[model samples]
Target: MRIALAQINPVVGDLLGNADRIHAALAATEVNGKVSADLLVTPELSLWGYPPRDLLFSAAHLEQQQQALDQLQQRLHAEQLDVALLVGVAEVAPDQQHPRLFNALALVQARGWQVVARKQLLPSYDVFDETRYFRASSSPSTLSLRVNNRDWQLGLSICEDLWVDEELHGQRLVGPDPIASLIPERLDALINCSASPFSRRKGTLRHELAARAAERLQCPVVYVNQVGGNDELIFDGASFVIAPGDDTPLLQLPEFAVSTEVWTAASSTDRLEQPSRAHQQANTPDDDLEALFRGLVTGVKDYATKCGFKAALLGLSGGIDSALVAVIAAAALGPDHVQSLLMPSPWSSSGSIADALALATRLGIASQIVPIQTLMEGFEATLTPALNAEPSGITAENLQSRIRGTLLMAMANQQGQLLLSTGNKSELAVGYCTLYGDMNGGLAVIGDLYKSTVFALCHWLDSPDAGACRAELGLGGSGPLIGQAILEKPPSAELRPDQKDSDSLPDYERLDPLLMDLIEQRMSGEQLIGAGHDPDDVKRIERLFRRAEFKRRQAPPLLKVSKQAFGSGWRLPIAAI
Candidate 1:
């Protein structure tokens, strides 16, 4: 049997539109008036998109989901397509209860569609509230298909259902082992439909898990993942098919793009001993930098388009963080659609101004100078009487930042563009940013990236390895998109004279590791000190992180590229001790 893995991008809450995308993918599988694949599988929750969130509670929205299924089925029948399509949908439960839906897959064929499987694992951890919406199924689901006078048994599972390997994940979800349950049935293949979000090196873990499952089930495993940015989550569609006993994938799709490819079951038997083209590509040393860059680009592109913003705006301070964000915006929205405001203050250096302009020119993005020195003086003069003294030191620095932020917002509002905040994760973690100043924007472009990561990604963009990716992103003539001047220079906000980031926070090289341990690993100050981090530094950084909670709560939504981000996944309270 030939099964087609349709890696698609679905818009959250766009039920009918998502259905059309699925149909378009199905249509692509047709050849000479005949469907090329016996069955096609899409990502989980493809109809209404993943994590529809509160939209799932709307009765009309649920009703529209049924209408969408009917429309898709009608389209298939009208096209006279003989292939069976498996799509994800929210199945209404028979008994009325608190959680009224089952995350399910429906088999749509010539006759119609039916719920073939229900997800058994409802993940309720970070970034997921599935338990609040869905009830777990009791057992595994398998479907029997007869093609060419032969019967094939296929095991069906959803995203979290296949993530039950305690050894691989280091921790297991409290639920039935879907892979183990299928072992007794002796399935032909196991299909996992997922909408898994991308994080650094997450694709590698996914490949390992699938390989493990294929080995245990003793069958080929086809994994289909959702692609595109849905809000803060970026899904890298690194879908693949793995044969039993082989860790290498028989077929692997590209990352961060929509793809559909048919894998013949018979071919896997013949090529078990030989490494496939995908395996060869996979073996070629993985570039985490390239993946990271692509993931961020995908996030920005989809966020802007999905949120109905045609252009992007940002304040370019000739600093690394803003420069990186400018590059991302130019790549995501075309250079013509991306604009920048060079908000130079009295403290802004000439070389920094020159660097920002040169970088903007190289990127082909429009840049306008919006000097804030006069505005800074005006604010100080006006607030002197109210304060009984002129705003000085930190207050003065923040006033400058706020002035630039206000100008960016004004331009964005006038142009109907998205204002991309340029704060890095290190700054956000250490409370180095002002609440409504540098933090004001509709979307935080690199808020999840550490300062060190920002520098590294910039260096990678200038490297030879990024040639293909640069071309793909339409970044032209980039010897060094972000020049050495901006890169080698010390990190600064330019809010005060010769003010360096190190003045307020630890060097990113030292601080980033500490922040990673505290935020991503959930380590306490004592744990950090025990891990050999400086005791005083740990306490100070921890205090700053906790104090910054209120700021993060009010900051714009940041794209999540890490296992833990300051977005929906990080649920720390602002009032916490």
Candidate 2:
């Protein structure tokens, strides 16, 4: 059987657009003679896009989806494409008693399209809320196709269906073993369609799961995933195939980009003797940071592009957070399309402005210096009558950020550019960010990156290995693109005189580790203190973290690069103690 994996990027709620994307890919491969395969597979919910969330509940959305599938089948038939393509869909179960929709896979051939598979193992934990939208399938879905006068049976699973290794997890997740059930029936290949979100080092987990399923079934596993950003969730389309008992992947697709590749396999009687080379091999540990950077860039680009913004602008403070955002934006939207505003207040150091300019120059991006001092004085003067006193202390400090935020917003609105927010995890975790001030952006580019990881990524960008990535992204400068000044300087809001972040929060070196334990590991305050974290600081940070829930709820959607980001997955009650 010859199979093609379409690792695609689909925007949520864009059913017609997603169908068009699938058609375009199929046509491109046909024209280039690269998709002359028996079967084609796309990611989960490729028609309506993944993480449709509440959009699935809308009868109108479901109606659009059905129309899209009809249109897709008509196009495929009209074009006379002979390839059998398995595209994901959202199907309304005929039985009205069940959940309205079943996350399904439809097999589209030249004649028509049919729902061949429905997803089981609906994961409600973490970022996934499929239970609210999709009904879990009670039985396995298998498809038999006759090619070259031989019958081939393919086991079909979607996303969480193949992730049923309870033994590895130390406990069961209260689900039937989808993979094990397929083993008894005997299959040619197991194809899994996934819209799996990206997290740091998540590729390993995927590889293990696929490999394990292949081992259990003694069949080749084809895993195709959605690639791109949908809100805060980033789908790292590191799609691959694993032969039975193979420790390493047979064919690994590229990460952070759309990829389509064809793999030809014999029937079960004649299995592949050796593993096939990956279409795009995984450069594992070495390229982890590169992958993360690429993921963020893709997220920003997709978010901006899909949201209908061609250009992006951000408030480029001389701080590391904004600098990183600028770099990411420049890479994502291109230097010509990305703009920056150095909104320096009177308290802002001269070097801060200079550093922002240097970064802009290094990135070859357009920027303007918009001083907030005048605006600050005017705001204070205007608000004095309403306040009954001068806007002083933290109020005065946050005013500067608001002024800059407002200026950036004005620039974005007038110029029609998406504004990028530049706050890090450390600041967001402890409520150090000013709401409606520096937190104003169409998308929070680095909201998931801890302060330390931001520094490390920047350092990695300056390293020799980053040349290819920098060049690929159209970044210039033979020397450090981020520069030593911006990197070596202590992080600060620069809203007030000598306003170092250290004054309010612990140094990133200490803060990030404690944060990882508390947020990602979900350690209790006592557990955190027991793990050698400072007790008072732990208590203080805990209080701050809890208090900041309201702010986070109001903040712009942030890019999720970590395991436990403050976006969709972090569902802490704001009114809780």
Q: What Cα-based lDDT does every candidate model obtain?
A: 0.88, 0.86
TM-score, candidate number 1: 0.97
* Candidate 1 lDDT, 1-577, residue by residue in tens: 7788999999999999999898888777777956788899999999989879988788998989999989888887887877788999999988889799999999998779999999999988878999888889998999998876678889999999889888889887887888888899978789999999999998888988998998888787889999999889999999999877876688888898887887777532443454344322242227999889888999999999999999999998888899999998988999999999998888899999999999999999999997888888889899999999999888998898888888888989999999999998998988889887899999998999999999999998888888878988899644889989988999988777888888888888889999999998999888999998989899899988899899999999999999899988888888878
Q: Please give the RMSD to the true structure for each candidate, in Å.
A: 1.9, 2.0
State, as a TM-score between 0 and 1, how close model 2 is to the true structure. Answer: 0.96
Compute the lDDT of residue 455 as modeled in candidate 1.
92
Every model's TM-score:
0.97, 0.96
* 1-577: candidate 2 lDDT, tens digit per residue: 6788888899899899998888776755553664476788899999888888888888888888888888888876786766788989888878886577888999988788889999878888878888888888899999999887888999999988988886664344577889988988788899999999998888888888888889889889999999999888888898888888777777788888887777776678767575456354664334889989999998998888888999999888777888888899988998999898887788989998899998899888998987777888899999999999999999998888888888889989999999899998888888998888988988988899999999999998888888888887888635688989988999888777888889989888999999999998999999999999999889999999999999999889998988789888888888998
